[model samples]
Target: MNKILSILAVGMVGACSAVSAADIIGTVTYKGAAPAEKTITPILDDPTCGASYNGKAPTTHFYAVGANGEFGDVIVSLKDTTGSTGASAAPAVMDQKACLYTPTILTVQTGQKLIVKNSDPVLHNVHLNPTVAENEKANEASINAAQMPNGADLNYSFVKPEKFLKFQCDVHPWMFAWVTIVDSPYYSQTGADGKFVIKNVPPGKYTIVANHRKAGEKTQDIEVKDASVTINFTFEPK
Candidate 1:
């Protein structure tokens, strides 16, 4: 009996240790000379496109912001999450302020959640298209503005293997958002100032991806073991 108890205790310790306590953090920025400021088009889905909105859903795209020819609202993620748990970090934000999707590129992991906050008083619909208008990977992931009268927060979990996901406000029709679900917890989004930090990572071989959303994405492999890893990546206009 004592032997069995000892074995169980060790098992529990092993399981606890496997918990990926590491963190990945970073910022998204433009390459080369930042382009002339130009307003992006709203990402609303056209009714004539025959997509399903059900009258209570949002399916439009927000105006897109592009610099260095790379548009905001792009997503990047790890292809495999087999032995990995979802990321451990504050939910990356996709704020709708001034009718624009802030930080068009967002990083997320499997089993993680996204909090949608309405910073503006105007009514807006939060619509999502995982595969976008052309691929149509799936349909109808929505948070209607009318449903949340005041400020609102919504958490979304990604359970499948997808390359990318897109979001928009049907009401405003000019609001747009993007998300990438990585299999591993080791990922980060570049901030406006163009910096990122990944923390507590287990020492091993890993890859880092720079998310440009519409401008496309770039990836780099890294080796780490004991302490934190610091790496920087830049993408030329695509």
Candidate 2:
């Protein structure tokens, strides 16, 4: 009986060790001069939409670089990983306020719910245009739905991974957003401060990727053991 108990204790310890995980923390920055953002003149010309901006037009968010060059809206993730609990994960949200998408860029795992809300007082439509060929089901998930003023939220999800799936407003041509669907839970989008963290990654080697819609992508190979790892990336203006 004692020998059996010892064997069971060893098995328990092995099971505990197998669940060990670490985190990946990183920062994304931009190098060189960022291109000038042009103002969307049509937004100011519109009657209802223009009123939300208080007579000032909004410029494009193509380069969301901070004062110190910290890059925002960049998707940092583990490449080629496939274990996603997105179906049960909390739904991601995108809001339309003042004739613009609150977050011009977003990241969600495959099968995760994306809730789109229109906070504007005018009429708007949520148009999803996915162009990936690898996942036919995801490509067929394209939808164009009209959302009335402060109307009901539109919900969507993808069955496979896709990059930069575009969401545009047909009513307001300048309003747009990009959603990158990752197949793994090990992904994060950099905030305005350009920082991100991917948590609970098991001890192993991984290919970390940082992708920007306009600046392109950067990748690095990394190994994680018991402790967390830090990796940084810099993207130059295109």
Candidate 3:
């Protein structure tokens, strides 16, 4: 009888431990009028790349603001977390379609695989330019590789954390993408609706940071206890 009671108490403790883990959810908003994006006329002028877009040209996506003020492309992450098992994490993918890189801004955990795919019919190059000194060794030495139309995917991973590591195509000077690498899995990117969620965060105090490529960053101290927490961030035009 005593053994049965002990087993039941242990099972109850495990269940409570599982329930203690919570999530962090929030939304990011822009405060001021968003800047107008300029049309990349050169993209439409090119013979090979321009054909992919038919006749219409696409403008830059510097600001993905919605009807209200919800902002997108902002990276929200927790500070001081490290030792990510990103190697086992699902791969993050970036694709080039219609002469442009989709999801111009992306975030991934350190050591996570990044697969770059060429979906366009024309040849394109993947060029990664990482500026951080600590990340130089982890980055690709050649930095530039060409990919034929419908070519095999290009795979990459970074050992260190770096923010806004740029990837560009020299063939299309206007083609660009930014990838931010975090040291842990506790990170989320705001969508077009400006909403984000970081899941399974243990009960603790942390410093959360929300960063925008053009608008800078904001940070706040938070404590996650029994239930999920909500923390919102706002940015203004610089």
Candidate 4:
């Protein structure tokens, strides 16, 4: 009887240890001189969506850096994480307003839903061109569809992992965005303050990778025990 009680106690302790979880929080900074800003002609004279910008050529948001070198729109994700328990049922959105794609960088998990919205009062076509690998010729995917003025949203999902899916509005010619489809929920994008937090990470060793649309990428390996782990990454231009 005592032996059986001891076995049950051991099992309970093991289960408790297996349930350990932690948070990964960090800030991503840019080193050296901030990247140069890029801009495209909004063609405000176009008698269509261009009017939404109020006859102003807006600066491109491809690489946004603060006065202190804070980097925005950097994707921080864990490598080799596989599972589907943390994804939310709520859909991710990419809004089109003023001839631009809001939150120019979007990240979503495999099988997750994405809603693309057009907020302007002009016709715009959302074109998605995914870089196809040599072996994926038969699986190449593309989306070239128009959204009417104040039109219905475009709902989409990708079944496989893709690093960068370029988005553009062929109608506007100046509209651009990118979507990243990941398999794990352990991912985040740095905000205008260059800060990000990834919570509820299972205790384990992981290689965390950070990527910016233009500043390039950096990686760091870390081991998370029962408590939170803080890691920061810096990216510099070549």
Q: Which candidate is the best by lDDT?
A: 3
Tens-digit lDDT string for candidate 2 (1-238)? 5999999987886776667888999889998889999898899899988887788888998998999999998999999999899999999999999889978898988888889999989889888877875544554443888999999998888877888988999999998899999999999999999999999899899999999988888999999876689999998866
User: Against the hidden true structure, what lDDT does model 2 obtain?
Assistant: 0.88
Q: In model 4, which regions exceed 4 Å deviation?
A: 1-18, 48-50, 85-88, 132-142
TM-score, each model? 0.61, 0.89, 0.90, 0.85
Candidate whose TM-score is highest: 3
| Superior by lDDT: candidate 1 or candidate 2 | 2
Q: Give the residue spans of candidate 3 off by over 4 A.
A: 1-19
For 14-81, candidate 1 gives per-residue lDDT tens digits of 77666544444444445565334433333223442113333333323322334442323434333343
Q: How close is candidate 3 to the true structure, as a TM-score?
A: 0.90
Better of 1 and 4 by lDDT: 4
Q: Candidate 4 residues 1-238, lDDT tens each?
A: 5999999987876776678788899988777787566656656667565565676667777777777878889999898886743246478899988778997898887767788999988788988877744313422332787899889998777766777788889987778889887778888888999998887898889999998767777899999887789999887767
Q: Which RMSD does model 1 reach against the true structure?
A: 11.2
Selected candidate, larger TM-score, 1 vs 3: 3
Better of 1 and 3 by lDDT: 3
Mark the regions of model 1 whose C-alpha exceeds 4 Å error after superposition: 1-31, 40-93, 132-148, 161-164
Residue pairs in candidate 4 whose N, alpha carbon or C atoms collide under 3 angstroms:
none
Q: Model 1 lDDT vs. the true structure?
A: 0.54
Question: What lDDT does candidate 3 reach at residue 20?
Answer: 81
Give the CA lDDT, 0 to 100, for residue 38 in model 4: 62
Q: What does candidate 3's lDDT look like per residue over 1-238, in tens digits? A: 5999999988886788666878999999998899999898899888988997788888999999999999999999999888686899999999999899987999988889889999988899989988876665665543698999999889888878888999999899999999999998899999999999988888899999999998888999999976789999999887
Candidate 3 — what's its lDDT?
0.90
